[model samples]
Target: MTAIDQSAVETLFTNARTHNVWKDKSVSEQTLRELYHLMHFGPTSMNCQPLRVLFLNSQAAKERLKPALMPGNQEKTMKAPVVAVLGYDTEFHEHLPRMFAHNKDAKSLFEGKTDFINTTAFRNSSIQGGYFILAARSLGLDTGPMSGFNNAAVDEEFFPDGKVKSNFLCSLGYGDHSSLFPRQARFEFDEVCRIL
Candidate 1:
């Protein structure tokens, strides 16, 4: 009904930055759970909530992910209190029977349609990933979302069964502003949008 205040807008959008460096503080498991609770409410087509997240917070897990990272992403990823491997489950439609109870045929709709299933899984999981970043920001955490890694390697390391695929990696924590580059310009609304 009503718009959120300017400070809330700033917290979630206008002033949010892609963090590279992080403060020494740690992100508690409770906070991480809360972040998921907040983002899970974001909508998806047919209620096909396909996104799966793996939070790499320990030294051993970070080590496992190191070889898959691009050189630029390694340091920041290792240093951040949490590195989230946001993935999409190819078998997401299997859950539709439970998630979309009113529509009994929802699961069957995607059962044998590989192309359609892939498209929906990727699209909706990506949308949820955006929600994840905003949810983290709303909770006073900063995020550095990067896609500069070997997807296959990440999948082999984290999702060995091949049912889930990595979409992107996001490093999260209290950001160190000193490491931020100057904000870049964005296209004006009129230039990027159409009202016809």
Candidate 2:
């Protein structure tokens, strides 16, 4: 396959920045749905596709999420147009029969294996979270993904049934670029990768 245009690459990665401040614009529910539709195609092991999302967009919803957020994250989350609580389904394997249809025994690989289930759930959900960010950027939205929060508190508040577990929180909106810090540095390919 041919490479995507450089501008698309810039939108998804090079020019994208983690935004903490937001402009006074709202993210429509339709946009959120579109974003998920775009991101959900990212591949996962056994096609487990475990990521689940809860978006806080109202004052009451933000207030309910407040106590679970870290002090440093509370203001940004409340002010952002949308705060996405990204999580994973504990029973994600139950869907393997349909999602991993090529392999009828896919669910059996995870069933009754507590440690394996948790690891797969977290790992695949994290992979999907990366897709979520890129999809948002491609749609001209800004993202601020942060992990400074109480996992148990979030799970209790939003996933009381214990069927899902929170992984991270990401704020989505039109970013306030005036307040952005300078872009940070990264290591060269050789510094972090190896050819086998």
Candidate 3:
């Protein structure tokens, strides 16, 4: 019978910021695995965990990514220790029997509903991506989530088979505050929310 402390939770939410620059340090593969293990618990629509991630760490892979990025984002992405391609599987509904609870034949729900399936896939994958950022931050790594890359090119380069599509990219590493701009402002809770 103990009251939940709000301040501690708030610190995790508020203190995390999008870091554009990173230190020379590298993030271990074990840490990335731990982050995934923690983030996997976040809920997804129909329990269909459609989010697929490709971690780019080597210089060659990062170089392959440079041409797909916006001019503003290239350097930040290239310098980070790890760059994650957050993507969604186009045929994720095919595995619904295993992913969706109580729905033994869940694939039938999307049999003739391609649009619905795609919408659900993207929606849930985006939620999972948010969870990933929080999980990385909780593990003491900073994140710079950006949508400044060319999706078509990224798809061509990484997911050439076309079964999955890139949603966004996140750079992870020890943050270099030297390049960070001042913290941006946010709307007040009253302005952004409504009490029903």
Candidate 4:
């Protein structure tokens, strides 16, 4: 496959920033669906695509989510046009027969193994969340991924069934970059990576 143009690369990563301030623009339902359709193609180990998302767009939904947010996250999340409750399904293995057709034993491997199930679910879901952000950016949206929140409260409020668990919260919309904080420094590649 041909490499994507430099502008596309910049749109997805190089120039994308975590936006805490958003404009008054709303993210339509269609856009959210399209975003997920694109991000779902991102790979996961054993095809255990466990990440689940709840998009809070209405005022009532945001109010329900308010108590769960930490003070620092509350304001930005409340103002953003969309807040995605990124979650993972502990029972994701149940879908393995359909999702991992080649491996008939995939479901059996995770069904009785609590530790392995949790590890795989969390790891893969986290990777999918990264894909979600990039997918949103690719669609001309901005995202503010924040972890400063009460996970237990969020899980109870959003996924009370106990089947899914909250992973993180991401606020999405058109960003207001005029109020953005100065960009922070990142570690040099040599300091963070090694060629084997």
Candidate 5:
């Protein structure tokens, strides 16, 4: 495969910013669906796509999530065009038959293994969450992914069925660029990485 152009690279990574304040502009439903279609193709172990997203776009829906969010996250999340309640499915392995058809024994690997299931679900879904951010950026939308909220409260309020567990929340919309804080420092390759 060919390398993506630098412009696209900047769109997804280099110039992408995690927005806190959003503009009054709205994000279209069609764009949200397209975003999912693009991000779902990202790889997961055994192709178990465990990440389940709940998009809260209406005031009433956002209100339901209000109590779960920390004080600082409430205003920005409430005003953002979309707030995605990202979760991981506890029973995601049940779909392994269809997701990992090549391995007839795939389902058995996670079946009855509580610790294993939870770990796989959380790890793979978090990877998908990262893909979700890039996919939104590629679609020209701004993102704010944060974890300052209460997880238990979110799960009880949103995922009452007890199957999907709340992982994090991400706000999406047109950002108020002027309100952005200066970018923080990052570790250099030599500081955080090493060659064998």
Candidate 6:
């Protein structure tokens, strides 16, 4: 098969930025569901799909999240159309046997090993979080991925369960062009990449 067009792929990668502001227009729940459906197809280690997304769009939910955010991020997160809480379930491996489609007793591996389970869960779920950013972009949405938050506070307010922990937060919306700064520069391929 012929390789995908380099320039076009480069455009998508280069042009995507962390949008901080958005117009007043709303994002439909259906659109969010579609995004999840598409991104779930992305691969994960051992088919252990641990990422759990919590979309906070309601006034009450956003209010609850306010205290957890850094002061700098609170305004943007609250103003954005939707704030996605990317989290991972420590119990993800419990369903791995079914997810793997035939690997019986997969749950046994993580049954009592809390440390190992947390490691795998966070690693794979972080991959899913990256998938979410690309998936949202593909659906004509702009994203602002942020980690400037109190994860422990967020988990207490939103997740509540110790098994599910927050990874990062991202604002999603139809971006406001008026709020964007000039695109920043990137290192040259030769400067950043080395061939053996």
| Clashing residue pairs, backbone N/CA/C < 3 A, model 6 | none
**Candidate 6's residue-wise lDDT over 1-196, tens digit each?**
6875866465357777889988998889999999899889989988999999999988788889999989998888899899999999989987887898677877887888989999999999999998899889888888999999999999999888687999999899999978899988879999989999
Order of the predicted models by lDDT, top scorer first: 1, 5, 2, 4, 3, 6
What ranges in model 4 sit over 4 Å off?
A: none
Residue pairs in collision within model 5: none
In terms of lDDT, the poorest run of 10 residues in model 6 is: 3-12
TM-score of 6: 0.91
Candidate 1 deviant stretches above 4 angstroms: none
lDDT of 2 by residue, 69-148 (tens): 88988898899999999999989999998999999889999889999999999999999999999999989999999999
Q: Clash pairs of candidate 1?
A: none
Count clashes in each candidate, considering only residues at least 3 apart in sequence or on different chains: 0, 0, 0, 0, 0, 0
| Residue 58 displacement in candidate 1 (angstroms) | 0.4
lDDT of model number 2: 0.94
TM for every model, in the order presented, reads 0.98, 0.98, 0.94, 0.98, 0.99, 0.91
The global Cα lDDT (0 to 1) of model 1 is: 0.95
lDDT of 5 at 98: 94
Instruction: Write the residue-wise lDDT of candidate 4 on 87-144 in tens digits.
Output: 9999999999999999989899987898998899999999999999999999999999
Q: What is the C-alpha lDDT of each candidate?
A: 0.95, 0.94, 0.90, 0.93, 0.95, 0.89
Ranking by TM-score: 5, 1, 4, 2, 3, 6
